[model samples]
Target: MDVSIIETSSLGDRSYLISAGAVGVVVDPQRDIDRVLALARDRGVRITHVLETHIHNDYVTGGLELARTVGAEYVVPAGDDVGYQRRAVGDGDLIDASPILLQVMHTPGHTHHHVSYVLRESNGGIRGVFTGGSMLFGTTGRTDLLGKEHTEELTHAQYHSVRRLAVELPADTKVYPTHGFGSFCAATPASGDSSTVGEQRTTNPALTQDEQSYVDELIAGLSEYPAYYAHMGVINTRGPAPVDLSLPAPVDPDELRRRIEDGEWVVDLRERTAFAAGHLGGTLGFELSDSFVTYLGWLYQWGAPLTLIGENEDQVADARRELVRIGIDDLAGAAVGEIHTLVAGTELRSYRVADFAALSEALREKDTTVLDVRQRNEYAESHIDGAINIPLHELADHLGTLPDGEIWVHCASGYRASIAASMIDRPGRTTVLINDDYDNANDTDITSAT
Candidate 1:
């Protein structure tokens, strides 16, 4: 049997293509089906089945369309009322695809109806387990995405679900999880990508603790998830549009300006230094990185038209892929050109980037308001003495609460701070970005608060 792990770095989600002989099966596929299809063609295998562990709340799934396109069986969990045609599967159900036999295990924690598929040979020898969000590398999936009301209950379920896997599966069985590796869906940060059932039983924190203790720990560790996540489950249930790889229409400078004037967002996908040097006035600087889709989806208004500005066509294409994952597909057009040339006569905006040492000195000269854009839990743990807490996701809504003066913005690292600076930076109001490593703040002479 052969299994290919396709990692979506932008969202930190993994999909698998498992095959034996000329038949293959896809598990937890993303919206982009081209890559999966190409892999099948390259391997000279026909995709016989598409399986979804649960209704994903992080990104749209292309499983339905992929299955339809390939003339394969679309298997989904029976717990969800996904108004669509599919082979609804439940616990103890067995699926046969030649040499690969999948046994469904109902694991409810990430969702009420989540299931993990245990792969075995025709002779019943355990090979691997596709433990979607139930079991991760060093932790389990966060149970709070559903809502606060379901948090405790789901966490309790997660404890039992993980325990069941450890007891039922062999120690050497490989565990493949969908959420981990920088995904916020994880209960805690994962140490690595893959882990065996034996490793998890010995090292996983959730596995070691009792049900109540595990529930408390999991609930307390969850930070603010993306706002766009709210719509994903519903969208996945209804099914999403087929992946459209065509590039968005190209817009010249005049059209870009016109859209900006019409209250449409002009997102500049460039590095922080390049964005900080000189960018179009009122153009939001969102660096094209793993966190691009996260912040953009959080800040951007739903259904609003957006014009993308990138250094080149490739950068814009990358940004489009990330945007589509979060259901932000209302792309008006894209502007691909040099920043200076595009905004010729207009005055470009820039902010001063400083270190913690500079921030300490600046605070001495005048009373400066420092804005800490980390999550609430992070802020609660420790922060600069006088800094105000306004998580980056909620910064736009709390702009009015900011006191007048030189505002010092920062996050764990420089990434989020750079984004915050671009949002709150103005013509007259000076905003200094403390772009240094957050750990360095602890060494500074400046007092800190918990």
Candidate 2:
């Protein structure tokens, strides 16, 4: 029997393949089927079992596609609501594969329905456990994602779930968690791609915290979530399965422009701050700082031809990679040259911002509209009076509500304001950037973007 850990960092995901007796099992594979396929083909092994620890939210999984290609059994928890073929395995259920044994563990916290699998070598009897998002090396699941009604109950449940794994599972059991460093799944890693149960018991910080404090801290620290979380679970539960991934041809700017003019939805893949500044009128804006790839799949329709306006040419490839992860394949290419030319025919104008004193004077004169694009905490901490707060993270959805007047955007620094200023696309709406960290300047303008 042989075990291999596939580091699928491209999608910012990690999965494992266990092979024995001519049959291999793949756990939580990423959207790139070719990588998984190539690895199996090279090893002269065929995938016969596809195990999804849970319905993932961070990125789409290639589990179903890989299963279809290999004629494997796709398995998930009965509680797992997903759109593809899957056999539900509950706690204590086991699958035998000559030299490998897998036992299912129900660990719900990251989502209402999630699972982990404990695997063992037939000869040694027990070797390791595959913990999906529910349990990472040293951290535990964040209970805030569950609906507000279940928040308290789930938080307590998560505490017990961690307790169960830490107390009941064998100390010698090697741990293979779903994600590692840089993944949103877990912040702290005790050691290695794997850990021993005993080691985690003594070292994992999550386990050391008393149940209540652990829950509060974890929930409180969660960043402003992606703009698309609520609809994702439902979509994954019943939406049409993701289409096959075949990289789209690179589109020329002229072709992209034609598509834009032809009524296809154009996406501005810069950060919210950038998009709010000034961009092609009517383009859907999502900043690269947020979860652009995941929300790209959620907010936009699939099969929709996508034209992009990014910070640079290099980001075009990065944007494409993320869109492809969830099977969104249509491309109309990127915005080239000064974006102003594209909006020249439209009324979307650009405005700039200066220091609070300058902004105050402008407010008195009523020359421009001020947009505060900082977090709620930052906005409450200290901000310019009379400035309307529409956090940069929520800019995409809330932009429609703002008055389409001369729009001046500002964040903590000039960098964010420059990005925020780009979202103004109406011919009449002039967008401007404010150097919020200004040491001397009183105001800044959209032209400040370089």
lDDT of 2 by residue, 270-376 (tens): 65544555556556666664346644554465566677776566676667666666555657556644566556455443344455556655766865677877677
- The models' CA-based lDDT, in order, is 0.87, 0.66
Instruction: Measure candidate 2: CA RMSD.
Output: 6.5
Sequence-dependent TM-score of model 1:
0.97
lDDT of 1 by residue, 1-450 (tens): 998998998888999999899999999998888889999988889999999999999988989889999999999999798868999999999888887789999999999999999999878799999999998988999999999999889999999999999999999999999888778788888878688999999888778888788888788778888888998999999988777766789998887777766767888899987888887877888899988998888778888788899999999988888888877776889999898778746777787888998888887888888999998888877788888889898888998778776889899888899888888877777878777898888888775666
Ten-residue segment with the worst summed lDDT in candidate 1? 340-349
TM-score for each model: 0.97, 0.71
